[model samples]
Target: MRSSVVQLAHARLLIVGGGAGGLGAASKFARKLPQNSVAIIEPSERHYYQPGFTFVGAGELRLADNQRNEEDLIPSKVKWYKNAAKRLVPENNSVILDNGDTLTYDYLVIACGIQPRFDLIKGAPEALQLEGSGVCSIYLPHLAEKTHREIQAFKSGNAIFTFPAGPIKCAGAPQKIMYLADEIFRKRGVRDAAKIDYYTSLPKIFGVEKYAQALDKVVKAKDITLHARTVLKEIRLNTKSAIFDVYNAEGKPSGETIESKFTLLHVAPVCRPIATVSECSSLVDAAGFVDVDPETLQSRKFTNVFAIGDTANTPNAKTAAAVSGQLGTLEVNLKAAMNGKPLGSKYDGYASCPLLVGGNKVILAEFTPKGPLETLPVNQAVPRSVSYLLKRYIMQPLYWHGLVKGYWNGPTTIRKILHFGRSN
Candidate 1:
């Protein structure tokens, strides 16, 4: 056993993930403190840029562009425990790893993010396990490889896309792929043979009223069927059919169980924070998400703990762009706490979702916590090729290099300069 004197330096700060938030947090802390003062616990061999999955599904970007080897991303000075954290023992100021190793820290940052629960939808896991089930998803990096093949080969019959009944990273992703499928079919001269449909459990096409109104128009104009409050019940890949339950908004049961034959089915599974975090009911909210103040991104219970990315219960739409915003606030507040000072940092609740509607077009949705109506000066509601270029090529690199390196602090500096300090 390692000696306690040399075990962990008392000033040690532990970050629970190696993803965007945890990486950014650790990078900032490493720059602020001594070499032995920080440690990061993560199990993944590689880190991924999740937002790129949208473009991957559209066949506009390759999955290779979004991944980074693990060793390269983590700061060299900080110690890394290559294991998942099973429980956060904040009372002891320590974290228990899956390997039974104990790590004590003066501060902790949780950024494990969300896990996609494909099993929640009946038959989804088993059916997707098959080599070629005509079903594909863009949620996992490895699975992103199969999307292009499935989409390109879809020639006729129903091409269906689904949105699950919960918060998800990049809320615009579900319909984005549907729009891409529509454009693809039209280009192949098989638009008439393809019955393109979008089924969402949400009440609207998009979350913000302005964006939703705009998207409703686009979906109608594109001839893509949109059904709300409809949930996928099962995937019958062997029979080339899917089962769904449609409900009326009034809580009245609609007896309609949809049975559709599909040549292609794209699903975005319902997601939740890893079960380990969710098990601690006090740390999470009603939906099993880390409960943090919308502005500060600090946990209500434990002041030392801060959360970012999809795992946090902040009302803002889950996006890496939002994590960029939260990272700055967390860094500032954490520094303040360490110095025995007050936390004056506040997040503007800013998040942006790049909706890749087709090969070279995207609808950029940027908004804040107060409301989703506010967006950038550009045509925020309209689909444009310019936005696609930024999202597909520029954003991923910006995230991995600038954001993770603690150089990018959201677009606050840029937004402030643009708004003349009038906007939040």
Candidate 2:
């Protein structure tokens, strides 16, 4: 028997996924729409501050510090559906939930964040589960503490970190953890005995040139070996080894395998779009990401639909800072579509990554397509203690209180003021 359908005709706004992006949109829409006119569909009881996971993995922050009850962050005015979205029916402007109920909305915001695919890598799932197996990942919330444990148990040998070939939530994270691990190893008196290596499928350390140059210096100074254009193929738990496939200039596998032994293996697993978003072939792009105008964040096919965060196929780095920058544009465009008006606000592709380089310092890599877009007037490429403090103290509180509450719209305005109106 088909489950009874619950029609919400008065629900003007339906935001999928209750992460930073969805919650931010919900908070904004709740102010404009009626008390029960906004709805958010999210199954998870605990909402994680994903950026803090790196710190948790580094043992600098506790796992509990990065999490909050889902009920606390979501606005009380918006109707909260503690359910998973099974499918997105754009033609009907409705979403099918796992409970077999249907939710129809006038305007939809798809923020169903990326899902980590650990099963894609051979032996990865099994390796991650085996305690003290020398395999760990900081990408998942549960694995952060495990990664810290792995780092703590490391006595010597290769401390290897692998970065996936595809787009990840935080592009800087894989390396950030590596830097933290380097510091940890040194503190534990295993630095001299261990060989630190970062194997990434990307051609460069970072996408932006300014920060990449700074990172190159750090890599050289720390004696860290960077193997670029390398993809992780398999993990041998029994031997504590990892296999890699090298890629050529054409991005094809070279059919060469490099087996490296490790006392600690940190893998940044490949990320894919959630089933609800990717299953809707009409809604996604060739890469399985929600196809939207990068600037306006409005869907090309459905005017009433918009996407933000990791789900959207935007050129900007997928981060909370990017979502914060995108919220204003998405809100303006979404509201305009409902009111039959043109989208006035535009996103400048602004994204910031507070690159933790150890030693109580961070290189704040803020950028757009045009190039290095720094918030402070000083050169942000260099590591500074102030940037680290901003990432730890200021950003955390701001994300929970300001951004998720829809009070913050990124650091663009602050950047402009600090740069004396020269900021892009």
Candidate 2 residue pairs that clash: none
Model 2: per-residue Cα lDDT at residue 25: 97
Model 1, residue 397: what's the lDDT? 79
Superposition error at 417 for model 2 (Å) = 0.7
User: Least accurate stretch of 10 residues (summed lDDT) in model 2?
Assistant: 1-10
Backbone-clash count (model 1): 0
Query: Roughly what TM-score does model 1 have, to 2 decimal places?
Result: 0.93
For residues 1-424, what per-residue lDDT tens digits would candidate 1 score against the true structure? 2211235334468888889888888888899898868888888878888877766876777888778887687777677777889988777887887867778887878898998889888888876666567798888876676777788888788888898877777777778778877887888898899888888877887778777888888888888899888888889877988888887786343888888888889888888899878887768888788898878887899888777888888888888888888988998888998888998998887888887766577778788866653335566678888888887778987988899888788877776676667573
What is the TM-score (0 to 1) of candidate 2?
0.97
Over 347-386, each residue of candidate 2 has an lDDT whose tens digit, in order, gives: 9999999999999899999998778888898899999999
Q: For each candidate in the order shown, give its overall lDDT on alpha carbons.
A: 0.80, 0.90
lDDT of 2 at 301: 96
**lDDT for 221 (candidate 1):** 83
Which candidate leads the pack in TM-score?
Answer: 2
